[model samples]
Target chain A: MTPETVTLILDIAITISLVVGAVFTLVGSFGLLKLDDAMKRLHAPTKASTLGVGALLLASILGAFARDEPSLQEALIMAFLFVTAPISAQFICKVNLHRRSCMTPPEPSSDSTWATLDTADAGDAPAQHLTPEKG
Target chain B: MSFVDYAIYGAFGAVSLAQLLAMVRLILGPHTADRILALDTMTVNAIGLIVMLGISQGTQIYFEAALIVAMLGFVSTVAYCRFVLRGDIIE
Candidate 1:
């Protein structure tokens, strides 16, 4: 293919990627606003918004190449986001669980309480030992 | 303008709208978890905006900024959750 054809193809790819990313992002945030429950709200941004950002980053990478200045910096952001999105989501879930903001999980057959709700034993809570004595 | 420019502009508009929606959620969220989730979503949207800006400007300087924002956002989200869960972030 000619240079012009390759550039055209890359541009088209970038444009398509940008459009997809934007639409997914808007949908994700809209879901966040419209969902009636906290857990349901969590479902939207973590997955859909992450995918949206990934698509945008993909477009950035393609755009770099289109400009004949290819770089991989966008990949760093993408990888960090992919790795951390679920983790943050999990933390948010834990917060929801701890606060009892959503439906509680079914009881475990063996454990008496869910982990998030379990209180630390006095013997096991080192924080108790770390308190400064009052004068 | 070409279709590509239109697409770029449209992406900007859509992402900005998304950011606005996330902010509305932040303000209207009924629970603490919902507020934290909104903050997290906002950070992600901010990163998107930064990336889009980089794309439009054809610059790489914003990469570090986006990465830092992502890192701090995750850390802040986790810290907020931990604080709410255990009443302490470090414990």
Candidate 2:
């Protein structure tokens, strides 16, 4: 294909991708409005916004490169974003759970059963023994 | 000077509207955690908007500004969440 044709194709692809990205973002925003809880609201934005911005960034890079310019720096921003957004979301969810008295703890399961046992054992053994009371 | 430019502008407008709705949630949220989630969503929308602007204007600086915003948003969310949980922003 000719250079002009190639550039045109790239531009079209980028435009389509960007439009889709925006749609996902708008859905995420609506999710924040509709979801019943903080954690549920958290899921929509991360899942949608991360990919939405990722698509837009990719478009930027492609558009730049198609026009014979450098483009990877935009990709770098996206790279950092993908890595960090989830961790921040996790942090917020964890802290929110801690602050609210009404929050329910996760259901007891075999995976966390040991942790509950450890806590119980610590609490029950209130004796301050210097050397395990002459048993 | 083409359909693509119009498409880009349209995308930007949609995201801006999304951001505004997110702001409503931020302003009127019943709980602190709800507000924080809104803030996080707003930041993500802003980053997307900036990237779209950078594409339309053909400037790389917008990406840099977005990077800064993303970093700050992450730090502040973590700090505020810590404060919420432990009554302090730091240990």
Best-matching candidate per lDDT: 1
Candidate 2 residues lying further than 4 Å off, grouped into runs, are A101-103, A110-135
Candidate 1 TM-score, true structure as reference: 0.92
Over the stretch B1-91, how does candidate 2's per-residue lDDT look in tens digits? 8878988988998899889888988987766777887898898899899888888888777877989988888888888776665455644
- With candidate 2 superimposed using the best TM-score fit, by how many Å does residue B19's alpha carbon deviate from the native? 0.4
- Cα deviation in Å at residue A97, candidate 2? 1.2
Score chain A of each prediction against the true chain A by TM-score and list the results.
0.87, 0.74
Candidate 2 chain A: worst-modelled 10 consecutive residues by lDDT = A126-135
What does candidate 1's lDDT look like per residue over A1-135, in tens digits?
Answer: 999999889989999999999999999999999989888999999999999999999998998898889898899999999999999999999877766678768989987987766766645433333332111
**Over the stretch A26-74, how does candidate 2's per-residue lDDT look in tens digits?**
8888888888776677788878878888888888888788667866988
TM-score of chain B of each: 0.95, 0.94
CAPRI category for model 1: medium
Predicted candidate 2: interface RMSD?
7.8
Candidate models: Cα lDDT each = 0.87, 0.77
List where candidate 1 sits over 4 angstroms from the true fold.
A120-135
lDDT for model 2 comes to: 0.77
